[model samples]
Target: MKISAIHLYAIHLPLHVPFVVSYHSYDYMPSVIVKVETDEGIVGYGEAVADEHVTGESWEGVYQILKNTLAPVVMGKNPMEIEKLHDHMNKTIYGAPTAKAAIDIACFDIMGKKLQQPVYQLIGGRYHDEFPITHVLSIAEPEEMAVEAAAMVEQGYCSFKMKVGTNVSLDVKRIQAVRSKVGEEIAIRVDVNQGWKNSATALTALKQLQDCNLDWVEQPVVADDIDGMVEIKAKSVFPLMIDEGLKGPREMLEIIQKRAADKVNIKLMKCGGIYPAVKLAHQAELAGLECQIGSMVESSIGSAAGFHVAFSKKAITSVELTGPLKFSKDVGNLHYDVPFIRLTDKPGLGVDVNDEMMRELTVFHESVYLKEENV
Candidate 1:
């Protein structure tokens, strides 16, 4: 079926509680929602983690890219040809990967729907019937973070992703405190969010976390500091995982060749969508690096899509699709839970947008404008 139309919306979902990180802390999540339509009457939806505070893209930037760049290339093209569609969009704007990723994922959703197969099948067969995932705890006081970790553990989440870029020494102390509370059995991972002062400073802090027996440390230094990544991996006792450093297979290869990291944390929003993730995972395998799929704490719309991808990608070492927990409410009526998050066993992404749920949560709205002729 040929593509017909595209609808874009900016949805702002208020957080259940404030979420703090190394960059800008927030009380709400702003996401750009994309709906790509086909002539055969199928609709595929996708969401982007639109954080001007986190990355360079803002809500306005999302509007421009979707309308001015991505829309024209795919308007009449076949959705089945994701690679060709991706190539066309790439030609429109040289090396604008993020914009391409947003559309690329929506197309994957469309292909999954057309085949009546879940996205997982499209990438690879299921590795686990039920996926064991971790709960990513945001930055807070050592005591507060520990209490939350305790509660998550009680709920059957054995792994915890701790946000450490707030205060280096304090970050170390916080992990030590959480480790003490959770015991040695519960797996603990640290995400500095690139909060390290420099390669030297990151190494100093990593040594402390290694002593604490961290499972992995994520983005400890600036993303471009591949040399620093190599240095840390050589010296760090704990395995290193690259979150910000990887854009796709190219970056994955770079990290692997440099021995920059031993593990990779792939996010749907960060890499644009799930297709590139599958390709990236293959490259990770060749390099003997482990893979984990995580999210940017999006609404259920985004999280469910990620769940489908994580379930489908066999190479994923662990899963982190926790946007529903952070949100006061999820967008789609569906919510995935427990040892494995089960998206409805329906075809495609297995999610039906719940209008009422969206109506209640969306506090931001904007119009897509065609500033140029082809947009």
Candidate 2:
């Protein structure tokens, strides 16, 4: 079936609590949702999150690109011709990865629906039913962060990722407080979020945090510093996981060749979509590097797309798909316990958008039809 129309919705959902990373504080999540309708009456849903710091994309930019540029290319095309669609997106667009990812995910959803199979199985049969997720504690006071970590532990979460690098002394105190609160046997990972200016500062902070028994450190130095990352990795006692530095399979190969990191974090929006993400994961696995599936603080629609990859891929060593937990509301019917997110048996992404909630959260929306010359 050919795609007949595309709908774009810009939704802003208030966070339950403000999320403070190293560079910015987020009080709300701005996401662009894509709904693809085919002539056969099948509909597929996708979402793209706007993170200027990460993907170099804004909500307005994502919406405009999808509505004006990408939608027209796929308007009358077959959803199953995903490769051709991807090529068109790459050739037409220069740097809008999240915008392209939205279309790719929606096409995959449509393909899964047409075939009457879950997206994960369509990609690859499930290797594991459920993968453990790491709960992230946004940058906060030492005692406050400790309390939050303890509360999450009490709720059945064993893995935790603490945001650090704002202050070395304060970060050390925060890690120590969390370790003391959670006690031994709990896994704690730290994310600097490329906050450290150089390797020397990262080394200084990591030295003090060594006693806290961190599982790993993520993006300790600036994203562009491959040599700095290699230097830090050499001196560091903890394994390093690259996040912002990895854009796609090419970057993954560079990191592997340089021996820069022990793990790589894969976000669908960062690499364009599931196709590239899966390819990157395979490359990482072949290079003997582990993978972590992450998100850009998105709704359940975006999170579910990441979840399908995390569930199906055996190379995924860790998961940070905690977007649903941080948000006060989501568009999809996803199940969340403390550390696990369960997917439905329904075909496609197996998550349905909450139409009423979506309308309430929508800030802007537009529909593009095949007959429209200018969407």
Candidate 3:
């Protein structure tokens, strides 16, 4: 069936606590939710949580692109033609992956519902029913960070991703305290968010961190610094994972060719949703590199999308869909057992959206419908 209408909601969902990375601090998540309705009355949900520093998209920009640019191209088309629509959208605009992600995810949802299967099954089938989720510690004082890590560990979280990029010495101290508090069994990964500034600084920090026994280090240098990544990878003791540096398959190929990183972090928003995310994961798999399905701090809609991709690929060794845990309130429900997330066999995303919560959280709204002539 053809798509009949598309609705957009711009929301500012308050974070449970301030989340600070290197480039910015997030007090709340400003995101766009997309609802795609078809002539057969099936509806699909999607989310877009963009960071101007990361994905180069703001909430307003994503909302505008969804309403003015993407909706027009997909309004009367078949939602099942997701890949073809992706081609059309790429031709229509450039570098709005976050915007395209909203539509791409919605279409995937529609496709799954129509086929009476879950998204993971439609993609590559599920490898596991549940996956471990990583708890991220925002940049904080050494003692405070250690306390938070201990608390999550006590609650059954076995994996942790620490945000450290403010200062080299302080960052080192923070990681050490957490490692000391949690002991050795818990896995710890560090994400600098390109806070180290340059290759030399990153090399120096890596030297100091060699003793921490980190599981991996992510984005030590800037996003565009491929040469710097190669240099740091050559010297750093910890395995390096590229995050902001990777946007799509082209960048993935470059990273593989240059031997820039040991792993790549795939976020649905950065790679234009599951359609391309699956391809990127396959590319990394072929190159003998591991993958981590990271997040954009989205609600259940986006987190479920990432989860599906992570479950579908063997190359994706790490999963970090913890956005639903950080939000004070969410529009959809994702069952979380502290460190692990489970999925149901329900069609599409297997998420139950709360209409009332969605309405309460929305700050802006719009609906686009196909014209009669187009139909």
Find the candidate with the highest TM-score and give its number: 3
Error of 3 at 44 (Å): 0.4
Please report how far candidate 3 places residue 308 from its true position, in Å. 0.7
> Which TM-score value belongs to model 1?
0.93
What does candidate 2's lDDT look like per residue over 1-375, in tens digits?
A: 888999999999789999999999999988999999998989999888978877789899999999999998888888898778888888988878899889888988998899988888877878867877788999999999999999988888999999987978888898999999999899999999988868999999989877888899999888888889999999989999999999877788789999999999999999988887888889998999999998898788788888889888889867888888887888877667657766666788888789999999999899999785432
Q: Which regions of candidate 1 are displaced past 4 Å?
A: 52-55, 363-375
Best by lDDT: 3
Off by over 4 Å in 3: none
Q: What local lDDT does model 2 show for residue 229?
A: 91
Compared with the true structure, the alpha-carbon lDDT of candidate 1 equals 0.76
lDDT, model 3, position 137: 96
* Candidate lDDT values, in order: 0.76, 0.88, 0.91
Worst 10 residues of 3 by lDDT: 334-343
- In what order do the candidates fall by lDDT, top score first? 3, 2, 1
Candidate 3 TM-score over all chains jointly: 0.99
- In the range 39-120, model 3's lDDT, one tens digit per residue, is 9999999999988988789889889999999999888888898789999999999989999999999998998999999999
